[model samples]
Target: MIPAEDRAEAGRPPARVRHRRVFYVPGYDPRSPRTYFLLFSRELRKFAALHGITARMRAGKEDPATSWHVTADWPGGPVKTTVDCLSWHEIAVRDFAVPKWRVALLSLRVLWDAVWTGTVWRMLRLNWKFGIFSLYPWGMALLYALAALGLVAACLTLAGAVGLPRLAGLAPAALGLYGLLRLTEILDRRFFVWYLINDWIFTWRHRTRRDPEADARFESFARRVADAAEDPSLDEVLVIGHSSGSFVSISIVARARELMREVEGRPRLALMTVGGNTPIAVAGRQPSPARAAMQALVTDGGMLWVDYFAPQDVLNFPWLEPVAAFRLDLGGKPPRNPSVRSARFREIFSEERYAEMAYRFYELHFQFLRANDRHGEYEFYRFLAGPEPLESVTREPG
Candidate 1:
């Protein structure tokens, strides 16, 4: 048992808290928000059963259209948390709605610029695994193009062999090209070649800060976050960013901090990024908005930042320091805010469970947001619905 005086020595949050507001910014996913709602509900039940706690989801909120309130009665105390999905689902839908030809051309431009500007080589130098991941979409795109061109060539050759005029070959050539494109579409249902191309297209726009729609959406998130921080009822405001959303969340939180600076008695602000690939957007020697956001967050020094990583998750840059990778300008002083820590899946899960999860790459990436089967330091459920404050639990023992 611990004494009250010992709580501070144990690394409690700077302030006492009865409630927390969690704003979850998901990655570039087009799925409905209801999917996330159900996933969280199911995971919360498992988390409660595993920890022997009473965590009840009262109901879903219609005002925000994707929010839930949960109450957890833990060993520490009864705490309430409101989890809001700051969704850009509609924007993703718009991306998918784009004409196929335009998406192809735009994605081609992203690849050409990466190659022309030597970004792909730079990426390879930084981390070969992720550099290869970056190349996959482009590689698949080129393969499709080559297949289409080869089909046209074959059709022309057959026409010549049959004593048909060159002009007559155009008809069969067009038809063959259409059939090949259709076949590729069918194949893409499995490979997701075009889907990945669109995803990278979105990432490229964000990297350059040229997407006005994204900028406008970021502004909306900033205002919402700033309003939440000023709410007197809330004791903590935690912004969660995962995968592609990590960079977006950083921009929103940084902008929101500036908006909330003049307010009085604001809630404790904090940022937590899980399986983040922030360097993908914010890196490089070029000055961009994403890079600027990284710099601003550090200079402001108003929020506690925590980054969680896993080496097994190839989607994220594991076993690397992000600040150094992003090449952030910090006046030659080591930034003290973000406390990077491992999720320790190997230490927490049994061998059988780990083996079952191995080779299923997407499952491993999503593990950061799932419940643990055994005790661990960084369980996603415990981080969100558990009794401890984000900062208090993530802070290092001194």
Candidate 2:
């Protein structure tokens, strides 16, 4: 009905897409981003059916094992996968009752993958630039030499104590050993912090650089999820963050918004933090620094932030309120009374509503990558689909 130029001027890109639901998952490894694809592929397939869009997911160029796939009616022929519904079913069953020895072996593989793919990847990417300093190599060499010296000195001290009349002389050697252990812990934390900052910088660079194709893909995914609802207006996009993933999502969302001018009328965004450690992203030794940039993005972007805390989750900050800060609890259980609001900034009042889904909480951070049906239901599926949409926006709260 419109002229060609007018129609073209209507938009830089078309608003509608082939699919109605699109989901993106974060990598389970704090240092690497492969786990997200492994867990969410099936759900992505289900979501594709809501709309007539074909989906195809593959590994990032860097990591392949943790990648996934989803499609509808695409030009490419269907992908051949060793994974199928039945395979996942058996894997799930075995994992539920996995033998101790097998689990131990699996844990070792996971550790190896994490160290090699996650840690080593960062080292190679030099994304953080921690070890890239002019003096960093020399400093590290010196530090290692000092550690060796300390080890030898303590051994000598122990040998000297062997001939002492009493065991009192051994105290110094024991103290030295204890000090060495403490120093290791301190170094570990520092190295982790250094790596985090570098990753953050890498992510930030991408956010600012502007990627139209990637943003279009995300917008397509968002619109798909929005269209799946009986009422598109009530379609709420909920982002659930686990462990270090909180950082990735928050950063992505913020970056997405900064690029909003490039794409107009994007979907409204809300966030739920489950066992999140986002603070560590900008966090230094201090409690909380001013991240007005991040805070402003969420605030202006119309984000309804709901943070879930399990008291038992030791990896995240316990006392900080999510709307304002972070909290650590045993699955971060919400109050029984649904009437009680979760926090000042949080829209969802109580955690009781999500209680049955509590097993998804990761007090044990590493459990995130482990295949579990509970996680499939509580964490991933819940986002893709939920109970029937309210007939009206004002429908009674359950």
Candidate 3:
């Protein structure tokens, strides 16, 4: 966090009437935090133009110790947004584009866990929920399997052409496999099957058993949240989570609140989960830490929680009651549910642009953060930098 006195020196316009500090937790993306920095820079400028709001953004220096900060000036406010991208890309990079043998072994492990734990049925339900988007993983698995088989066949053909004996063909097959793997690496930059599997593996590890590294990371993130919540200079502390981050955000907020008890006079804390895939991750799991965290959040009365989903994106479950899905007991009373809001992407994009990217499921899932083609409701920029409080903004539909 930047000190109030140093904010002006950091190139932001002096002081403002209100201050909003946003902590963004991105989903299973392996990209650097710089990716988000650029995205915010582009979208904030467009959002300001589209809404006719006088907004100016100053890109701050990236610091791993304090996280990436972007200062935005809007009506009645200059919001300081920090992106806490809790990505294990370092772990993902180790095996994401590795050889076919490694990926095959990992996929088998994921499938076995899903089957043994009855999560396959849960996956089926998720597929039914998200339609084609949910089926993408299965499709990617099949595509990779078929591609490997084709490579094997091509290797055998090359072996025959060279008049090699039976066992001699194995070497050519190995070389062909390596080539195919490299090809998939090039292709996966656009179509992220391998990268998706990396995400699934992380989710699977959390679902089945505790991952020590991931647990430590979450705890560290929660501590950071607690620190921000306790900051006296901040007016509001907003935690925004997208996609797989929704579940992680829930856990972080829950843990942060527990730590917040130590700090008196904490700032207003709010949670906004967009394009959330919590249900998919928690599916078919019994009483677990994730469920416990969800229970804690839904039952907590202090903070406001809003969940945003769009029907157009098959990656997220829209209008789903997370408390009910987690099967948490509220002590025989009605529980407070998160404000489930519909995010209309079609309204956000023009007809031409919508048609162009409508079938691109992954792109649609990210509409939550991108600059809207036309202003309707649910402006991402306003939610972060607007004058209205987040709780009040979500109270009225856009």
Candidate 4:
């Protein structure tokens, strides 16, 4: 049932005003030690205006203590709603136009790990190849382990020696331990450097920083949404998951479904997983908790589940028969001289229906939140649901 507030303004035709409160979940820890590329409600406001959808967007930091809310009017008037961003991590993970962003983050993370690992190996290699222990693997292992233990001992001895009258004696002992610990930390940093430069550290940091007991934490947020949308008539509480947040989205939906079941007006939900990372999460021996949770949502809740992928966004998984596949040119419009922009998207989007919907408004994953659209097409943001006739809207300043 439409809200009485919305019903009061329902007379407009071409502008079917309805509330679609979008929750933009940042891909990883929205914030980290380094610079964070933020996604703002203002961007959403712009898209809402273009679509004639009025929206008030609220953004939140990665801090679990905060909340995000948005209410807006569009396509004419008086559509109101609040979006909870902190709680929408799951929806962000599950639905969106492009899955590649998540993939890119994960892939870059893996590559970064590989780089750091390579660095450590190189540092260790020098000793293994030409240092005093070069000839004997077994001997080197024994010596290194012993030396590591000695380093620890020396530090303790140094601390004990610190208050003693012999400062000179303490210096030698402290030096050995300090050098070893410093070396270890340097090697660790070396291992992580690749990710640091590329901005992929955000993913690792968020994952590592998340609590060991994450369920209660996630369940708390899910309950809040369930409580707020308690009125049974709120259509299907559809959840949209995008990029890495897909990991969180699946978990919440499953938990929310269970929690709401006891309520008389439990919501029927549709889990839309866009540019997701389910496959990535499940690629190894045992599926990650996030992947397992996603599967549970589908099996237990009987939720309407759909997944979207874009081939051009090298970051998506190679899952066959995805619910939808979008064809976007991450490469700027196929050379203007050859009418590349017109030809490329048409060629790629023509063969498949899901791809067509997915590609309707193609924005490169990285460029989605950016204001500057170098290729003239907002791409992803412009076609959130798909492309619409924009010629008329473009003529009028919206």
Candidate 5:
């Protein structure tokens, strides 16, 4: 069983953390790091008030991304954390910069590849809601396209009925259709059609050897984690990756392990991924370095990975067990590294609060990173800027 890999020494909880280093890799979002700084800083205040503790965050160098310091005095003890958020918004904006028409065409091609290659069916079998979510943007794109074509046909018919030359309506019909298509683009801001398209395109490209430069960037993040791990004063080097950022975190942690020289007295190195389903990037027949990295970390005994899975969230795959789903070749090692834990969100929020955000999928998907209404076992902000070491917080199954 996977639990066997983490038993005994490998699963032993580290000492209560005093000084910690936190690395955050946000999802494929183009928002500025200042936004995340505000999100976390505000949430820290809410957490302190709820727990009746003292906690504060001060911004550090915050240009490309934010570097901040957090000090929290929980009932257990006082702890200080240095938090660094890796920024890739410039790269994301480049992906966003693709011509809208090209994004649609590329998205169609990518979607077709997934369906033609049985990727969609595979994903549906894994988690139906997530499969539907994957198809949501393209489905809307097709709907709007059909609406435009039907309007053009109606315009042409009206012209012919009035006894004008059928071609007489061509100019007006073309203009009307163009206006309708432009309206579709305007609607995209509300639906995030092109934005989701860019995310899938990036994921497809990253795993298919089209985004080697991103890997080059990931290596720097890995080196940073490795550097933090070797620092004896820090109790833990914790990396948190959410959404597609999970894709990068998996590879970086694996690469960091490779970069780290075997040494005694190193701080515990750990990872937490929220919103599962990242395996889509590397789940095909073709071998990929990302897939290889996943296997190494899942089977490795040195580090801990807790996949925070929220079943009600439609944006992520539910019930994903990578070792079983990906058919990772364990090579006789116990599958113990990733302790999949259910994020009991319903319990964290009051019934009214839960119902209010239940339909807001994006808000729910992001709840993993925010402070809960009630202090539950999964106090994310507490675990993040904390006296609690990752190992101790995640050692027991939730």
Candidate 6:
């Protein structure tokens, strides 16, 4: 038999109790928190079985006030994890389903802003820098144009069917345009592009307008985070932000830190941003309140901030450093930047599955939250329920 000290450390029991509280903030999604609970439950079971670990996740009542608890029985000991999904879906739903005219106006406004602020040029530059043309949002504009053309062609076809010889000349155009638009819409939802543009507008308004309801919700979320941080039973408090939620999470955490100064004992706080699109939210607004909040979080040394990006995900800027890209001014010497790690979705899914979803932008963006087919350092379930701490787990990407 091998000597005790020579034995594998993985077989040894953990030195400290494992209790973590996680706050998950979703992106510009209109789904309820129940969606996340269901996703977690499904993914946790699959990952646990694959890793040969005894893990069980039971979702509590579908209420924003309550937490979903997960338990994992590992070689070291049992780990208790409580996750709270801070959902802003209500806001998203209100903004995304506007009338067709409003969508057109918003799309026009987005284009105007892109031109006025050189956002279009910046996007082109990014495409060249990354050597990936998909980084440009031109596909969204093309989809919009095709959708409008399809609607017009449908109207023209109906007119032609009613024996209008004048419109007969447009018949061939109608057939080709309608068929192409339908196929494109089938691949990527037609409204997604408009919804994304509207989300950016909403961010701009939230920063500029300072709406009372939005401010109230922001305060409420920050208070919830502060409550979690102050809980003595928790060893770690992690705030997870995905996509648009990345910028919102930054603001919430900055506000939470402000409120935490009043609390006597706060747990170790950590921030994890996956497939983040923060640069878009803060773009064209230098010296803005949103930028100030982001700067505060980046410079705050007490919290451990880790951001994960996948090169294949075209929605998020993989090479943009939040601090340098934003031109954040931290007083005196700058603190270490957030540990930005690269995650590989190609490794997470099978070759067949990856190839099937190669062009699905949203699916690739969300790969950060799914169950991984290959064992990697960035397993979503393991980060939420495993024995290891998030800080250590995210130190290096596999």
List the candidates' TM-scores in order. 0.90, 0.39, 0.86, 0.46, 0.93, 0.81
Q: For candidate 6, lDDT tens digit of each residue in 179-276?
A: 75456446446336555666666666565554556667777999999888878777778899998888888888889989885444446787888888
lDDT against the true structure, each candidate: 0.76, 0.36, 0.71, 0.39, 0.80, 0.71
How well is each residue in 1-398 modelled by candidate 4, as lDDT tens digits? 11112211211111221332333334443243122212544465555655565555444456423344445443344444334454323322232222433533554455455344442233233223221211122243235458866766665666667674444455666567567645643653433222222223333332333333445656775776566434554333445456665656766666665676445544334444555434333322332455345445433313344444444443333242211111112233211100001112323233453343453322333332432212233233332222221221122211
lDDT of 2 by residue, 1-398 (tens): 11122211222221222222223334233423333454456545544444334544555344355323333343333322211110112222323344433433443443343344343333323223321321232345346448756776766766667775444545665676567645644774644322332333323322333334433444543343334222233333344455544544454444444444332444334444445544433332222212333454333413343444333444443333323332212234332110101111112213442354344333244333222322222233323333211111111221
Residue 14 of model 1 has an lDDT of 40
Worst 10 residues of 2 by lDDT: 336-345
Cα lDDT of candidate 5 equals: 0.80
**Candidate with best lDDT:** 5
Shift in Å, residue 22, candidate 2: 5.3
User: After aligning candidate 6 to the native by TM-score, how far in Å is the CA of 237 from where it should be?
Assistant: 0.3
Residue by residue across 1-398, what tens digits does model 3's lDDT show?
A: 11222211111221332676787888877676667767877898898888776665554456663365555666555666655555555555554556656776877788677667655676566457564455467688788779878877777777778888655777877887788777877988788777777777777767656477777888888998888888867767889999888988888899998998545545677888999887656665665566778888776666777888888787888876765555677776445547778877777788997887778878878889988888766889877776666665555643
Best to worst by TM-score, what's the order? 5, 1, 3, 6, 4, 2
Q: Distance (Å) between predicted and true CA of 90, model 1?
A: 1.4
How well is each residue in 1-398 modelled by candidate 5, as lDDT tens digits? 24633533543456688888999998888888888999999999998888888999988755435789999997778889999898677668888777777887888778877776667777777777888888898788888788877887888888899998777778888899788867876886778777788888888887776886777788898999998988878888889988988878998899999999766777888888888568567666566677888888887778888788788898877666787777788799876567778788888878887898799888888888888898787878877776777766666656
Q: Model 1: runs farther than 4 Å from truth?
A: 1-17, 116-118, 262-264, 332-334
Name the 10 consecutive residues with the lowest summed lDDT in model 3: 2-11
What order do candidates take by lDDT, descending? 5, 1, 3, 6, 4, 2
lDDT string, candidate 1, 302-335, tens digits: 5666778887787776644556666677777545
**Cα error of candidate 4 at position 321, Å:** 5.6
Question: lDDT, candidate 6, residue 197?
Answer: 62
Can you tell me which runs of candidate 5 are displaced by over 4 Å?
4-13, 62-64, 162-168
